[model samples]
Target: MTDDRTQDAPVEDQHPQPIDDKVAGILVQEEADLAGHDQAEILEALRQRFADAGIAISEDELLEQSVRIAGADGGDFSDR
Candidate 1:
């Protein structure tokens, strides 16, 4: 029998990325409930959250990823 999966839309598209791989980015994104919090405050909270989630990312690494994500999204961290 022929495969039914479409080439353009992989199975992963139907699901969220593995949480561990994206936990930091997802947390820093504007979509999270982080309204009105400045960058420093957000990062502190994120550091705690990461530890709580058992993801051992260094503060520098977390800052780097957050900056990267913010830059990629035009630094627009306003609530959606």
Candidate 2:
């Protein structure tokens, strides 16, 4: 049988464009820990961190990456 998860999950890039996957996850997690899991806050945190590092990233790209990295409560991302 086909895996339901594969069907439902958004295809992720092999590597994040602006930063590393591990680094993105750490940033996402830290923002959540500090700000209580609000998507906007996490996204802003990611945007700011990348900016501070002199990495140019688009808002659309960051939002998409954040969903994969942060995941909603009980969402597919967290399961992985």
Candidate 3:
């Protein structure tokens, strides 16, 4: 599925990339691990993981549902 949110954005293809299924699995595993932790801990862990992976995502922006699910009311999914 194409995401309308990013569909209109331009991507810089600076390098050739190869498909790696392992990377996809790792991401899924990270989300599963996050699901088992509290909101705060999950966010911290996610931030740390992102840093380790050389991905930049600040706590303020990372706190969004895409990285962690809030336990408020019916809960808000990061829609990531």
Per-residue lDDT tens digits for candidate 1, residues 1-80, read 98896768646556657766566465655324454446666667677777765667777876755554444444455432
In angstroms, the error of model 3 at 49 is 0.4
Itemize residue pairs with steric clashes in candidate 2: none
Q: Residue 21: error of model 3 in Å?
A: 9.8
Candidate 1 C-alpha error for residue 51, in Å: 0.8
Per-residue C-alpha lDDT of model 3 across residues 1-77, encoded as one tens digit per residue: 97666544335234434324423443455565555457777666666766765555555766763334434323232
Tell me model 2's lDDT, rounded to 2 decimals.
Answer: 0.58
Q: Estimate each model's TM-score.
A: 0.44, 0.45, 0.45
Off by over 4 Å in 1: 1-31, 65-80
Q: After aligning candidate 1 to the native by TM-score, how far in Å is the CA of 33 from where it should be?
A: 1.5
List the candidate numbers ranked by TM-score, top first. 3, 2, 1
Candidate 3 ranges with C-alpha deviation above 4 Å: 1-27, 70-79
TM-score of 1: 0.44
Tens-digit per-residue lDDT, 10-46, candidate 2: 3444334545664565554644453336667677778
Residue 33 lDDT (model 2): 55
What overall lDDT goes with each candidate model?
A: 0.58, 0.58, 0.51
